[model samples]
Structure formats: structure tokens, C-alpha cells
Target: MKHVLKNALLLFGALFALALAGCGSSVTDKSQKTASLAAASAEFPNADLLVSADSVQKSLNATDLLIIDARAASAYATGHLPGAINLQHSAFWAKGRGLKDTDTVAAQLGAAGITRQQKIVIYDNTTASWGAAGRLFWMLEYLGCTDVHILDGGWDKWSADGRPTQRAAVTRAAATFTPSVQGSLKATSARIAGRLYDNDFAVIDTRTDEEYLGWQLYGETRGGHIPRSVNLPYAWYYNTDKSTLRYQQLKTMLESRGITPDKEVTAYCTAGIRSGYAYFLLRLMGYQKCSNYDASIWDWADNTSYPMDQAPNYADAVYPAWVKALIDYHKPGSTSAAPPQYSYDRNHKYLIFETQWGSFDDMAHGWADNSYLLGHIPGAIHSNSDVYENGNPRWFLLPDAGLKTALGSMGITPDTTVVVYSDSNIFAARLWWILKYAGVTDVRFMNGGIQGWQAAGYPTETTINTPVATTYAGATKPALLASTTYVESVYNQPTAKMVDVRSGSEYSGMISGYGYVVNKGRIPGATWAYNADDSAGIYVDADATLRSYEEVKSLWSNLGIDFSKETIFYCGSGYRSALAYLYAHLMGYTNIRNYSDGWEGWSTNYVEDPAYLATPAVPGSTDGWRQDPSGRPVATGGL
Candidate 1:
């Protein structure tokens, strides 16, 4: 009986322990449920201004909820959150200028089924670095949308979290949208210009360094930024992954750049697309007195009278004493016996050589056609290249006596600093080389030729001017010219680098444009260094300017051609190669030579000798050679 009683007690104790554990678990589950509910309903600091993804998801079915996809139509068409209406951000702005008309913007928003009464939640692809959502957010506020909010992390977070999405378009009943234009939100050109030098105001240029530094890749009349403006590229506001804004970091960067909240900040870009993003960010960060220069640099730069800070000067406003000294030294009548180096300054006698060779238009061929009457540089003399050539084929540099006569006719003395320019620069280089070879002490190729000069906003003239002819005596400088024999002797040497500056097709033996050269191939032991920006030729920039000095240096360095080696540049008929020779000289290369006759002369020797064509076209092989009985024999050495 005692044993039975003990068993009952043990069984009751076990039941009691189990019951306690179950009660504890029930309490813990209730606590977890409360915590989850709290997390799901977590609110942003300004819930009226911004909303979290979870909040937006929960309110998706609400009658007053108006989900807006602010991305482009193409992106919105792919796949968007369920029931989101597509309204592209760009629609808020004018076609090419400032903001659109208030009535038009309002009517468009109404057509998109946006009503002021609805609770608006805006979003974009959220994967791009651009502030599309922010831009729309600002636009809505400008239109006086009472309950507008931007979706945090936007569609990226929503889709990534396994939320429902639909490809089908969503439409809503048309509703009236009343716009309340905020005059203070916009900074006009006059207003921004007035505040440019104001200490209390800060003008921010939100563009790439290339644009800010006035490279003008976007086809501006002039290449420059607004005077007294600081650059803060819009991309800096977002994280590298573009997942979300780096709010605190951006605030710090702004403060460091003196773009403080205390100052009246105005931001601008090419056409205010980027500045609109900056405006939204400043507003979001509690900057009260911020305005967007909606007209932007496009409008500002278009107005020629407005001041612009040009490159190299804007960045380095103060020049050192040594730099100033160098500038003075290069000026005319400096009393320095040294010859003038390559300069873009208009301190020398300008000569325009308009050649019509190759793809150039026939109507504009040479100076004799009076092409200079169209538009020539101010105070420039037009000289014809056709008149300066000798030999049956034509366009060859004239003999010493003929060159002297031609130079004298153009009033170009031996000591005159002639700055030569042309449309293609190929002919200009030929003229420059010819002048240099003929012992003209100071001849410089215009850094970017006539195209660059015109782009720089320099003066142009239509009226022609004639200068009195002068006596010119010149002596040929043999060191600058590379003969066929001279090229062959050092071509295979380790210290020499022969750069074939022809097109890729010509260098690869694909198509020899010349009729005389029956067979096609590069010179033996020559490296193909085509002067091309892409697959095209070197003249690629909008203004046909030479690529930056660094870019040209990198191109040569990539091909293992450095200052240490003797570089030989050549091309078809030596025209394009002459430009390369001038480039090498400007780059301060010590041992650079131009094969003046180029492939025209080189292949002539091969065509004259049947023995050369009998053997296979093998690069760097002695079998590719033959004697030219015409006295210009194929170079013979390492063979």
C-alpha cells in the first residue's frame, strides 16, 4: 500500500513539472509575437516623408495607397511590385530647359491617376546609382502632394525579399492633381550668378570631373564650369553597391566641403537631372535654404556673356613663380636665343593649310579654292600645299630651291615663328615637317590644329589678307629625315622601335591603297602601332583634338615603346605619320624620326625588284629584300 502511494506522488510531480514548462513556452511565444508586430510596424523618423519597404507592403491593399514606379517606362514594363503605376521622373522637367509648366505637370500627374488625397509611395529600380526616386519625391512635394513618401531601398529591397511582383500594367481612375509651385525651390540663372561669389552661398556643380573640368564631352559651346563653383558629383551620395544612400557619410562629405546647412546651397548639372537628385538629398538632410539651379550648366554655358572657369586654370588658380617665369620666357621678344617650343598661344604668325586629300571634300580642297573665305583664323595667311610639291606623283616636299621660293612667296622667313593648322592636321604636319627640314628655326604645329582653335572661342575671319613676299634662304636638316637605307639598318635593332602609324588594315597586309604596291605587308621587323582612338583613326575627339597627353603616353607605353628607344613613325605617303612625328616631338621624345617617303617609297623599291616579290612575304626575313637598280636599293645590313 505504501509503494502504491509513492508511485502516485512521483507521477503527479512529473505532470506538475511538465505543466510549468508548457506555461513558460506559451508566455515566450506571446512575447515573440509582440516583438514581431512591433518590428513590422517600425516607423521612419519622418514617416510622413519616408516609408520602409515593410510599411509599404502592408499598406499595398489600402484604398488610399498610391504606389508609384518612378523608373523609366522600359524598366517598369519588365516587372514591378503589384499595383504600382509607372510615372517616369524625367516627365517632371521641361523638354530641354527648366521645369515644365505647372498646369502641364499637374495634368500629367492627374492622368497617371495621382490625386493629392492619396497616400503616395514612390520607388525606382533602386539598383541604379541615380536618385530617380528622390527626384520624383521632390517633384511631388513641389506639386503639393500632402501624404507623399519614398520607399526605402525601393524595388530592389522589395523584390529581393521575395515579395510579389506583376508584369501586367496597372491603371487607376483619372483624378485631378493641383500643383502648388514652390518658387523658393528653384534658383534661376540670374539668382545663381549673383550669389556665385557670395560667402554665405555655395554653388555646387554635380557633374563628372571631365565635365566639371570643362572637357565638354556633352557638346557645350565652351568647355568650362561656372565661376566660383565647387564640384560634388551626385554619385557620391550613394553606396558603391547602390543598394541605399550612405546618409551619414554623405552629410560628412558635404560638411567637409563647406557645403554646410548654414549656407544657402544651390546645385546644378548639365540640365538639372542630376541637380534635382542633389536638391532632394539636401532637403532630406534638413537643409532648409537649399535650391536647385534647374536651368543648370547647359543654360549657363550657352549664354556666352556668362563667366566660365576653364580647365587647368580653374584647378590651379595660382601659378608658381617658376611657371610664370616660363610663360614670360616663351612670350615673343623675350630676348632668349632659344627657339619657341610647341604653343597654343596666338603669339606667332598663323598659317592655314587646307588640304583636300583623302576623304576631305573636293570643294574645300587646298587654299586655291578660296576655302579660307569660308572662315580662317584671324590674321592667318592661306598657303597652298599643291604649289609646294615637286615630282611626277605630286604632293612631295619640293627640292631646296623650290621650297625656298615657296616659303619666300608666303612671306615666311627663316626666323619667323609659323603656327600652322589645317582641318585634318595631316597636311599641317607635312608643312611643319617640311619647314623644319628646310632649316626654318621656329615652326610649331597648332596643338589641336584649326578645329581646336575654333572650339577655344578664338577669333575667325572671312576677309583675306595678303602679305608682302620676302627673301627666304634655307638649308636642309638631314637629321630630321630618315632615308630608306637608314630605316632598314636600325629597324631590327633592340634599341629601335619602328611604329607603323597606318590603319590596322594597311598594317595587316589586308588592303594596300596604293596602286604601285601590288603585294601588301608591313615593313620587315616593324611593329604595327596604328594611330587610332578606337578601330577608327587617332582623330576621334569631338573637336578632332589629340587625346590627352597622358592618353597618348599610355598608348605608346602599352606597345613597349618608351623614351629609351629610338622611335620611327611612318604611314601611307608619310602624311599621317608626320602628325605622329609632331606628337612625338611635343611629348619630349629625344630620338624620334619620320620616314618622310613612308610606304610609298619603301614599297616602290620592292615593286622595282622582281627578286623581292619572288620570295614569300615574311616579316623580319632577308628573303623579302631585293636590290633597286634605280640607285634606291632595299636596305641591307642584318640580312
Candidate 2:
């Protein structure tokens, strides 16, 4: 009875205070908002942490409904959610400032009209710019705000759906904020330094793999992350449309990375902003024991004694929607739009080719299947190897006139930008070399190929686009290809490296990798850089997508090849080496060439040194192999 009386008196006192203030039109109170979001609350244990933009739209009339725009003041000045006050989220924490005192934070938040009891919504471009709203929500939670929530999908989602926005600046009556600061929410650098090797503790670096792998990004005192940190990245949790993925699939994805409710997880980025966003995600995912390493790498890396490790590599890719955005983006109805671009000049046209051997059916699904010839990117034409090269027994580029006819028939020109991909990374690479050799100015080879496209959960089309044929000027880049004479000249030179991108067994002279190539011996001085050996699984990810820069560099370095030397790459034929050459070229190595003659020309037609062959050839070795130049290991693992 005493407790009930005290509550009644408090309620009466609140109403009395409101009566003294003339306008009490703001805020519909907490009960009304909860009733509106009952569905989300029912769907997940912590769904109330987020509120839909629809709810915010409905509540726009409430003057006391504090909506904070967690973006730059410039962005807020342009346009923001109705009545939202601009507050840059990154200002919450800083390198030199660190996490501020509760009194200081509360005073600032109160000036922004945020109180402990008011209904508040914070929003930002959540999927872009490291999800600023999430960090704001984290800060609010730490300050003991029980009625705060983030606007789901934030500004981008609301604006994209044509929701209400305003340009007028808002200044609300300042409300008193009392901070019940939660220190556990923020993990100091000292805390993480001690827990680096603890199995039960998981440290997630919420930065790109490039930054984690020793790049000195964001003014870090040193390169690389704290030792034993796993890079989950901030963008991985978002969809192509820039919304955070919710529910079971998201749970599974997180669990796969060993991030679970059971572990005391700590997330960090260059500073605290990205990591604060990460903390919000963890809490939303129902993980109770999570914290943000606010100082993160900036401070930790500066300490010389702190342990650090650099990673070898990661996958190279672009988001599927980024590609689709290029495909679909059109400006003002008055403005002229250009085609999908790979060039600085957006007006330049480009072609997507489904590079493959033999027939169109081989590249697509069988004619009888219900897939409707699926398995290729939309608007891709089947670029058959048969038409472009001398096939059946040998695979090599045709003469210039034949090449011109083959290329021109496919609508290729010196000016056209070409994109090629294949189920076999080698085939795509081979076509890439062919186009580059024929003097096509720009050609892009999708390193991940079809598997990469599929793995990204994007849709593909089987539309066999007909090329609008263009006449090609017959031209060649002789420097890209190695002639027999050129190969012999560089064969044993210390100034150049002959990289054999073949399988170990083939390099060891066990058997010729192809039926057409009868020779089993390798070039005497060729370095065994591993190849497309399916069984060996060399030079690629488990899914056969391209390896990253460091991985590729390491592979070559291990085989006596380096960017410093002029590299001449070869395989049983030229196809496999072309793939390796493509990777090197993309990595900015210009002094590289693919020898089309490969081992076929070397073993069958090269004038071998009589003394070198006269001695018994060493077994299972590159240079000392006996009679019959067998393919060592080309095409074992793909590019």
C-alpha cells in the first residue's frame, strides 16, 4: 500500500509539472510505442532494441519523441528525420579523449534533449559509414537509457522507401539526464591485451581483411591487428540493400565463426566507432557478455611490447549489388545514362563473356534441364575456345587474320572493355591473355568466376546474348607472349625467371598432363610454381576462387619467382600459365609474359643442349627429368 501510494504521488507530481509547462503536446508515452512494436518483440528476444521507420513515421507528431540523427552535421543540415537533432556518433569516443566521464556525457546528451525516461530513436546510414546509429545506441545503453532504440535500416532505408524528411534545424527544451554508466560495456585496451590467447574469450576485429593483414590504415601506430583476432568485418552482416541480416541465417553465420552467446566476445576497429556498432550487433543477437574495445588498434598498436601478427591473404571481391548498381544506376530523367563501366570513362561500352571450351551447352546447363540454361551472369555471351584457338589436339592462338575473324565475330574491338569468367579459372584467364595479346585495351577476369557469383547469393541468368559484331583491326602485343627463341634466351638467365605453373608430378616428369602433349620432360631451369592440379589443390581457396595478393606472392616466392625478376610463365599448353600470368599482372607486375609454346614447344621442338640431355635425367625433379617431357602439374589447382 505504501509503494502504491508513493507511485501515485510521483505520477501526480509529473502531471502537475507538465501542467505548469503550457504545451504538453509532445510524446505519446512508452506504453503506446510498445503496443505498436509488439510484433518485433514477439519475433525475437531483443527485437525491441530496434524500431521500424514506420513507427518513427507514426510518432513524428510527438514533440517529446527525441529522434537523434547520428551523422555528420553537414548531412543533417541537408535533410534528416522530422525533428531529429544532429549528433555525430563518432564524437562519443576518441583516441586522445578516450571514453568520457559520465557527468560530461550526460550534460551533452541532455543538451540534445535526451533523458533517461523519454522515448528516443537514433538513426544513421547503418550499412554505410560503419553504422553510426548502432554506436549511438550502444552509448545510450551504456548510459542506462531503458527506452531508447535504433531506427532499423536507419536513414538510407527510410529515405529509400520515400519516408518523411525535413531540412529545418530542431532545438528542443533541454532535459536533465542522469547517467547510470555501465563500465562493463566498454572494454579497455588493457583488458584485451591480457585476454589475447584465452580460448574462452573471442576477439573480433571489425575491420576489413586488408587492414587486419598489416595495412597501416587510420593512422595506426603499427600495421596489423592484435595477435589471435578474427576479422568478421562490419559489412559482412549487411545485405546488398544495406540492411542488417536478422534471424536464423544470421545466427548460423555468426556461429560458424565461433562467435556465440557462450563466449565473452570483444569487437574492435581502428578506433571505437566500428567496434561500438559491433557491440550493438552482438547484444541484438542475444549475446549478453559482449563489449567494445573502444581505444582498439590505435592505442594498442602504439605499444611496442603488445603482440601482433600479420595474415597472409584473403579473397578479392566486390559486393554483388555494387555490380548491379553499376548495371541499374541512372541519373536524373534529364541526364544521359551510360552502360556498366570498367573504365574511368563511364560512356565506354563493355561486354561480359562466359568463356568456355567447345560448345555453348558446356558453359550452360544441358538443353533438357529445367534450369533454362542457367549458370552464367546476365547478358553474357558464350565465348567458345574452339572458334578462337586451334583445338582438337593442340590449344594455341590462331594467326592474326584468324584471330581477327574469331574476335570480331564476337563483337570485340580494341576499344571495347571485355570481362571474362569460366567454371575453370584457367579458361577465363586463357581468354584474358588472348584478348590482351590481341591488343584489346582493357579486359577484366572475374577471379572468383561463377562460384564466387553464386557464393554471394546473387541471381544469375542464362540469356545467351548475341554479340553485335564489330570489325577488329589485326594487332598483337608481342611482349605479352614468349616466342621459342625468346624462351631459350631467358631460359637460364639469372635476370629472368621461367615459372612452370604445372602440377608437381608433371614437373617431376611422371606424365604429360594432357593426352595431346606426348613430351613429359620440363624445361631444365624452370621453377616449379604449383598449378591447376585438381588433386593437389594449389594456389586457390577451397572453393577454387582466386587467392589473395599475399598468398599469390608467397606461392611464387616459394618457387624462386619474385616480382623483381622478369617472369616467363608456362604450363603443358599455355592455358594454365595464362591464369598465373593474369594474377601477376593484376598485382601490378608488368615484367611478366606467358609462353604459349609451353612445355609442348619446349620438349618437342626446342634445340636442347646435347650435354644436358646426354646425362641420365634425375627422377621427380624439374630440370633433370629423363626422356619424354611429361607434364608436371598444370591445371591441378585452379587460379
lDDT per residue as tens, model 2, 1-639: 999999999999998867644332233342443324322333545787767666677677665577889888888899988778888866556673456777888888888777888777888886555767777777888888877777777788777876667799988778799988887887877888787778789888887645765556467877777766766667666665555677675687568657878989998888777887788778878898899877788888878888876542211222233344444433224243332333344555677787766565643454222222556777778787888876645566787789988999999998886777777778878888899999998776665567766765777886657899889995889889997678877777888888888877788778778765555657777778877543355655445555444456656776657768788999877888887887777556789999986877676532256675566354332222332433332232222
lDDT of each: 0.64, 0.71
**Candidate 2: misplaced stretches above 4 Å?**
1-42, 312-639
Q: Supply candidate 2's per-residue lDDT for 95.
A: 78
TM-score of 2: 0.54
Candidate 1, 460-485: lDDT as tens digits = 68766665788888777877777778
Distance from true location, Cα of 550 in model 2, Å: 12
Q: Provide the clashing-pair count of each candidate structure.
A: 0, 22
TM-score against truth, every candidate? 0.44, 0.54
Error of 1 at 418 (Å): 28
Q: Can you give the lDDT of residue 580 in candidate 1?
A: 73
Error of 1 at 555 (Å): 32
User: Evaluated with lDDT, which candidate comes out highest?
Assistant: 2
lDDT, candidate 1, equals 0.64
